[model samples]
Structures are given as structure tokens and as C-alpha cells.
Target: MARVSQEHLDARRRQILDGAAICFARNGFHATSMQDVLKEVDLSAGAVYRYFSGKEALIAAIVEEVLGQVRDGFEEAALSSPPPPPDLLVSSVLGRVLESKEFLTVDGRPAFPRLVVQVWTETLRNDQLAGILHDGYSAVQKTWGRIVEAYQDTGMMRSDISADRVARTMMAAAMGFLAQQALFGPAPHEILRDGLRALMSVRDPYDTTGGSQLG
Candidate 1:
């Protein structure tokens, strides 16, 4: 018998993970079982287990995959010419999060938000998962902090505030929005856009540079 190529193995693993994500999103983590994943993938038990040892392993892979997509978005934004303003930056990132097909149901509802909340709950009871989550958030924070600092240097953001703090605040707000969206569907884009602009200290349109003071 001929041995399977590495590319085939990788493709098989990705296929299983995709099916597992759909199952977890529909039935949630605890409610979802390996059998559910197997059925979703239409693969034999042996084939599924060859990629992930258990549900926990599948969950870990899903988290890593999601985080990798987020990291790629950040990198893409950072490399763009005439980089987006802080507000646009935040909007861009969150837009990608909300619009990602990887985390959305076929009916246009978000799946990842529910899964993320489930993971947060799991982290409370699982120390290993907790560490993984903490590490992922830390890396994301560092990336955002760099962006915040650049904006501050250009006087686009308040210098009085700590870059790290701003980054953390933005991250928290984004997570909150995700949770809210998952529960109530998406808020108005304009409302979200304005709120992010306010948070990022985008210059007031009516305020002229060195304008005469009001009498």
C-alpha cells in the first residue's frame, strides 16, 4: 500500500476541523461530541481521531485557527499604504471578525461569538485552556499597543493615555460587541463606527487648527 502524502494528511485534518467547527457552533462545545463531529465530517471514527484525539483537541485547533486569521488581518492592515486611522483600524478589524465566514452560520448568524463565550466559560474550569487563552490575548494586545502608540506619536490620539490601556480597552469593547451581536444581532454600523471614532480620539471636523478662541 502506498503511503499518504503530507499534503493529503493536512487537507484531511482541515476538513475534520471545519466540520467540527460547524458542529460545535450549532450544538456548542459540551453538547457536541466526537460522534457529532464524525457525522458532520461524514468520516469514519478512525479518520477523525487520527487528526484530533478528542473534543478538547478539536477546540484547541479551532481557537488557534481563529486567532491565526485575526493575526493575519492585523498584519494586512499594518502593511497597507497610508495606514488606516485608529478608528478605521478598529472598525476594519472588528468588521473582519463579524463578517468572517469561518465563524458564521449559513443563515448569516454569528457562530464564533457563542463558541468564544463557551470557551471563556471552559477556561474558568480548565487551567491549560486558560493559559492558552491568556497567551493569545497577550499577543493580540501587544499588536494593538503598537498601533496605538503610532497614533499617539502622530497626535491623532491623546498622549495622556497609556497605549497599552487603550489597546486593552479597545479589545474589551470589541469582545463585548461580539457578545452583544451574538445575542441581539448586529447593531447599526453608524453607531458602532461613531463609538469607535470617539474612543480613538479622531479629530473633530469642526475644530480648526489654531483657530481663534471664542470671545
Candidate 2:
């Protein structure tokens, strides 16, 4: 038999990861069996081992992959054209959360969200995961912070407002909204839009009614 090149190995690994994503997203990480993924991808159990050591490794890979996409998305949004509006900044972050559903359709409803929620809980118990999740959140905050700074520079926001603080608060609000959505199952975009409106309102503190302040 001929040897497979590194490229071939990596391609196969990606395929396995894709399968694992579907499994994790659908079945919930704990509920998914290696055999389930193997069957989904039509790969033998032994063959799958060549790509991942075990189920836990597969879950970690999925986390790393999804989180990487989110990080990349936020970075890309920073470079996005038209200069991000405050509402759009929140919209972008919320959009990414909703996009996790793309991976969830593979196994079951609430699959990827459930896994991420579990990871959030696990972070409370595991220092390493906590650090990873925390850093990921910080990256999100920084991305939004840059957008807020841009808005401030253009006079869309109050010059005195701190972009970093606003960004951190927005992301924190987003995390809370995600938790709420997971619990209540309101329309996905509903919380996102509402949240963005609330965040944007901070920039406009006065209303036609003298007593009404946006902030």
C-alpha cells in the first residue's frame, strides 16, 4: 500500500472533525457515542481512531474548531466595510451565537448550544477550560470594543464613553441573553435585536420627553 501524505491525513482529519461536530451538535457531547460518529461518516471505529484518540478528544476538537470560527468571525467583522454601527456590533456577536445552529442540525436540536452551555458550567470546575472560555470572551469584547471606538471617532457615540468598558458590558449582556434564549426559546434574533437596541440607547441619553433618558 502507498503512504498517505500529510495533506491527505489532514483532509481526513477534517472530515472526522466534521462528523464529530454533527454528532456533538445533535446528540450532546455526553450523549454521543463514538460509534454514532463512525456510522455517520461511514468510517470504521478503528479507522476513526487514527484521527481522534477518543470521544473526549473529539469534543475538545469541536470546541476548538467552533471557537476558532467565532474568533475569526469577530476579527473579520472588525474589518467589515461601512464601519460597524453599535447595533450591528451587537448583531454580529449574536449572529455568531445563532450560527452555532449550523452545527446543531447534524444530531439534534440544542446540541451545540447544550455542549457550549455545559462547557460554561464545566469552566466553573476546571481552571483550564475556564481560562480558555474566559480568553475567548475577552477576544469577543475586544472586537466589539474596536467597533465602539470606531463609532466614537465618527461622532456616533459620546466621545467620553469608554469603548473597552462598553464592549465588555455588551458581551456580558450577550452571554446572559444566550443563557436566557437557551432557557426560554424565544426567537433567536429577538434577544439580539433587543440587546443591541439597549446598548445603542446608551449613546443617546435624551428623548423628546424631557424626563426620558436613554441611558
Candidate 3:
């Protein structure tokens, strides 16, 4: 018997993952099962099991793939000679989130945010999943923290506050945006960018008079 080529094996693995992603997105992690995945991918038990042992394994893989994009998004920005300002950084990152195909469902809905809500709920009961999520989030936070530190050095951000706190606060805003996106319909990226700019701006965009400034 001939062996399967490496490309074939890789393709099959991705097929299983893609099918699993759809199942989880549509039915959620708890509602989705191995049998559902089997039906979704039209694969036998043995074929699917060869790639993933169980549902959580598939969840971990998919979550890692999703979070990896978030983690890697900060790479080039983190190394800039003069780090991006906080509002620009937030806007740019959220803009990418809005544009990424990974963040959309087959039906073009922003289901990625909804999927993240499910993962957070699952983490309460699944320690391993929590660990996976925590590690990924921490990595992303560190990237933010690095930028915050640079901002402080350049006197762009306050030097009195801790970079970790600033990073965590920014992460909170991003998470809140995701929750809002998931709960509501599609929101324009300008909402994030403009909002951040408004919060940081000394002059109120609405105030036409130069004498009137934002507090």
C-alpha cells in the first residue's frame, strides 16, 4: 500500500479543523460533539480521531490558530522607532480584527466574537482550556505592555502608571469591543478609532470653538 503524502495528511488535518470550527461556531463547544464533527466533515470516527483525540483538542487547536493572529499582529508595531500612540494602536488592531477573514463565519456574520464568548464560558469548567487561553492572552498583553512602556519613555503616555496596568486596561477595551460586536451587529471600525481618539483628545471633536476643550 502507498503512504499518504505529507501534503495530503496536512490537508486532511485542516479539513477536520475547518469542519470542527463550523460545528463549534454554529452549535457551540458544549452542543458540538465528535459525532457532529463526523457528520460535518463526512469522516469516519477513526479518520477524525487520527487527527484529534476529542472535542477539547480541536477547540484548543482552533483557538490557538485564532489567538495566534492576535498575538502576531503586534510584532511589527512593537518594534517601531517611535511606538504608535495608544489611540492609533487600538484603532489599527481593532481594524485588523474587523477585516480578518478568520473573524467571520461562512455566512459572513461576525461570529468570531460570539465564539470567544463561548470559550470564556467553557474556561470556567475546563482548566486546560483556561490555561491555553491564559497563556495566549498573556502573550498578547506583553506585546501591549512593551508598546506602553515605549510610550511612557517617549512621554506620550503617563510615566506614573504601570505599563502592565495600561496593557490590561487596553485589553479590557478590546474584549469589551468583541462582546459588543458579538451581541450587536457589525460595528464600523471608526467607532473604535474615533472613540479612542475622542477619549485621548484634548479638544472635543464636537466643539467647534477652540476655546472649548475636552476635560
Candidate 4:
């Protein structure tokens, strides 16, 4: 038997990963069978095994894809603006969620919060999954921390606060709000805006004009 080329393997991997995401998000990580994913991707059982040995492997790949996209979004947002605002970060992150109406109801109820909860809980149970998720999140937080430090350097953030600490605190608040939004029907944007305004109050008032000539 001939070995598949890397490009072919990558393409097949993406197909499998995408199908697995839809399956896991719909049927949950624990409940989604390998057969379900194979059926979703129209792959033969042998082909599925060739790509991912087990359901766990498929789930991990799906999580990696989701988190990888998130990390890329953050990095792009940071580079797009020299010192991105807290509100921009919050909006861009949550906007991804809001854009997926399949995952959000008309009233802002997350359609797949259970799937998210399942993945998060499974991470706690599996060291490998936990490590993967943590690494992705650590990268995200570090990027935000760098942005926070940049803001401080530009005199837009409070001088007394640690950038890392501020990043952690803001991420915590954002995560908590997302969890609440998953459970409740409140708009995340409004909640995030008000919360960011409160957080930024610690520093001197900076107008929205990108720190240009302040009167």
C-alpha cells in the first residue's frame, strides 16, 4: 500500500475534523460515536481509523480547530490595532459566538452550551485535553497581556497594575459573562461594554480617539 501525501492527509484530516465538530457540537463529545463521525463525513470505517484512532482523538482535534481559530482571531485583532481596546477584544471574541446562530438562540441562549460544558468538563478529566486547551488559552492570554502592556506604555492603561494580572482578570470576567450568557438571555455586548468601562475607570480617562491629542 502506498503512503498518502501530506497534502492529501491534511485535506482528509480537515474533512474529518469538520464533520467531527458538527457531530460533537450536536451529539456531544461523550455521546458521539466514531461511526457517527464517519457517517457525517461519508468516510469508510477503515478510513476513519486511518485518520483518528478513536473518538477521543477526534474530539481533541475538533477542540484544537475551534481554539486555533480563536487564537488566530486574537492575534489578528492585536496586530490590526497597535494597542487594541478591551472592548474590541471582547466584541471580536463574543462576536464569533453570536455569529453562530446554530449555537445561539434569538434571545442569546447558546444552542450548544451543553457541548461546550462537556468539552470543558472532559478537559478536567483528561490531562492531555487539559494541556491542549490550556496551552491554547495561555497563548491567547499572553497576546492580550502584550496588548495590555503596550497600552500601558502608551499611557492608556493604569501604571500601577500588572499587565498579566489585568489580562487574567479581564479574561475571567469575559469567561464568566459568557457562561452567564449561555445560561441567560442577556446581550453579551452590552454586559461587556459596561464591564469594560468600569474596568478602564482605574486608569485616567482616555477618550475613544485612539489616544490622539488629549485636551
Candidate 5:
């Protein structure tokens, strides 16, 4: 038998994944069986199984792609000459996720966000998924912590604040924005930027003594 080119194998895997993404997006993970995905791709059971053993495997691949996007955005910003402001970084990061082609369905709609919401619900019972999410989050937090350090070096934020705490705090807000976006329709990225600006602009009027404004 002639050996299949690596390109051909990749295309086949993509075909299966794209089909699975559609099925999962429309009917969800639990409701959409392997047979449904196979039907969607017009592939035999052996062919689809060669690429993914089950829905969890498919979900893992999709989650990894999104997490990679998050890390790439943060890493790029952290390595820039001047790291982005906290608000700008948050909005940009969210924008990258929403615009990622890997998350988009065949219909040009973002499918991963809704799929992730479903994954979040599934994680309560699926330890493997919870572990995957935990690992992905930890990796992003580390990069985000680096960004916090970069901001501190530039005097953009408080030096007294722990970088880990700041990273986690900012990450929490960003994830909250993502959940909101997934549940509701898309909102202006300016909403996030404006909210952060308002938060950062608050003055400590009661402080008479000289102290850090906690900006």
C-alpha cells in the first residue's frame, strides 16, 4: 500500500474534527453520539476512531487550541517593548479568542465558546476534563503573571501587589467576560475597556496620609 502523506493525514483529522465540532455545537457533547459525528463527516467508524477515541478527546483538542490562543496573546504582549495596559491587555486577549478560526464553525459562527460552556458544566463530573482545564488555566496564569511583572517594571501598576494575585485577578475578570460573551450576544470590546478604566480611575478620597492609590 502507498503511504499516505502527512498532509493527507492532517486533512483527514481536520475533517473529522470539524464534523465533530458541528455536531457538538448543535446538539452538545452528551446528546451527540459518535455515530452522529461519523454521519456528519460521512466517515466510517474506524476512520473517525483513528483520529479521536471519543468526545472527551475531541473536547481536549478544542480546549487546547483555545488555551494556546490565550497564551499566545499574553506571551506576545509580555514580550513587547511596552506591555499593554491591564485593560488593553484584557480586551485584546478576549478579542483574540473571539476571532480565532479554530473556534469558528462551518457557518462562520464561534462554536467553541458555547462548547466550552458545556465543557464547564461537564467538568463537574469529569475529572479528566477538570484536570485539563486546570492545567490550561495554570499555564495561562503563569504567562499572565509575567505580564504583570512587565507592567510593574514599567511603573504601570503597583509594585507592592503580588504578581500572582494580580494575574489571577485579571484572569478571573477576563474569564468572566468570556462567559458573559458566550451566554449573551457579542458586545463591544470597548465595554470591557471602559469598565476597566472606570475601575482603575477610582480615587481613594478618604486617604489623607500619603499612600499608594492602589491603581
Candidate 6:
């Protein structure tokens, strides 16, 4: 007769989402069913349905959770006390993608990349999922656009290039790197570190000759 506490309800929702993520990560979203999620969670049909109406709802929740973390990561970097160097900021964000426990499979592989590919494929068929992904990417691009403008104003980045262009380019590069990592294993951190340095015009740490300096 006792009512479920708010914390308990939230925990249950998270449990269901986690199980769904694992299922979708292993099997493509189209191949995954509500029954698969129920079995993964070891919960009854009614119990799982209480949190998510169906597989689509569960996929939405998973995408939102992943996108939320990405947005928060960029926001945090932008608002740092002493703003991180461009290369560091980019490296830091990508590094977290490599390190995030939430994205890892039980066998210690990065599951997010596979999930991302599945989501992209599903977006072709599912309008709702496409909209959700579009909104998430828009939010991230807007935040990065602001950050790029701020860097330009500070002379840390080239003012000649458009902030919107730079933001889009950066996002594309990040996504490309993630896709590569997800398909293969983790990439050397130095590859991303150096790549961001070149893209953002950050000064090379190894170059002691101060011919070209970064703001």
C-alpha cells in the first residue's frame, strides 16, 4: 500500500534505460524489441512500461542522456575559471568520450559509437528520432558557436573565419573521430591533441621557437 519514493522511481527509470542501452548497443535499434529490454532488465512487462512506453521511448531517453552529457561537457569547458586552451578543451571533451563509463560495454568496448550508428540509421526511417537528434545537434552547435565567437573576440582564434563555420567543422570532426573510435578501438590521445591544435591554431608545445605564437 506504500507509495514509491521519488528517488526510487528515478532509480527504476535509470535501471530500465541502462538495460535498454545495453540491448540497443548489442542489437541494432530496429532489431531490439521491448521484450529484449524487459529480459535485459529482468523486469516484468508492466514494470518496464511504467518507465518507458515502448522501445522508441527508451531509445529517445538514451539519446537524450548521451546528448545531455555532451552539452554539459562543452558548457563546463566554456565556463571554466580560466578558459581551457582550445586544444585542451577539444582534447578534454573527446577524452571523456573515450573514458566515459556510461558509453562502455560490459566487455570493455565503447558501446556509444555503435549506438550512434544505429540511431543515425534509424533516423532515416523514424521522424521522431530524427527530430530529437536534430534538436540535440542544434543545441550543441549553438553552444559551440558562442564559444567560437568568444575565442575570436579574445584573439585566440582567427577572426577571418566565421564562427558558425568553425563550430560546425569542429562538431563534424569530433563526430568523425568518435565514429572511427567506435568502429575500431581507442585512438592515440596525441592524434586528437595534435589534430585540434592544427584545427584551432593552438601553438605547438614542442616548438620552442616562438616564431608563431597563439593568443
TM per candidate: 0.82, 0.71, 0.84, 0.73, 0.86, 0.86
lDDT of candidate 5 over 95-202, digit per residue (tens): 767765445563565676667677788788889888988998999999988888887777777788899999998988887776786677557667888899899887
Ten-residue stretch with the least lDDT total in model 3: 206-215
Q: In candidate 2, which residue ranges exceed 4 Å CA deviation?
A: 2-11, 22-42, 80-82, 100-103, 106-110, 202-215
lDDT values of the candidates? 0.74, 0.67, 0.81, 0.71, 0.80, 0.79
Candidate 2's clash total is 2
Q: Tens-digit lDDT track for model 6 on 1-215?
A: 99989999999998898788778878888788888888988999999888778988888888888888788888887775445666777778867755764554746876777777788889999999899999998998888888887786676665767878988988887788777876886675568778878765645688775633334
User: lDDT order of candidates, best first?
Assistant: 3, 5, 6, 1, 4, 2
Q: Which ten residues in a row are the worst by lDDT in model 2?
A: 206-215
Residues 108-193 of candidate 3: C-alpha lDDT, one tens digit per residue: 77667777788888899999999999999999999988988888777676676788999998888888888888788668767877
Which has the better lDDT: candidate 3, or candidate 4? 3
Regions of model 6 farther than 4 Å from truth: 106-108, 188-190, 198-215
Q: Judge candidate 5 at residue 21 and give its lDDT.
A: 73
Candidate 5 ranges beyond 4 A from true positions: 102-109, 209-215
In the range 1-215, model 4's lDDT, one tens digit per residue, is: 99879999899987787677667756677787888888988989998899788988877776676677667777777675455678767766766754553432323344444455567878878999999889988997998787787777777765567788988887777676766755564565666877777866653356565544322
| Best-to-worst TM-score order | 5, 6, 3, 1, 4, 2
Task: State the lDDT of candidate 1 residue by residue for 1-215, as single tens digits.
Answer: 99999999999998898788777877777898898888888999998888789999988888877777666676676565435775667667777766765454635766667677777777888787888788888888887777767766666556667878988987787778767866776564455667877754544579675423211
**Comparing 3 and 5 on TM-score, the stronger one:** 5
lDDT of 6 at 192: 76
Better of 2 and 5 by TM-score: 5
User: Worst ten-residue run, lDDT, model 5?
Assistant: 100-109
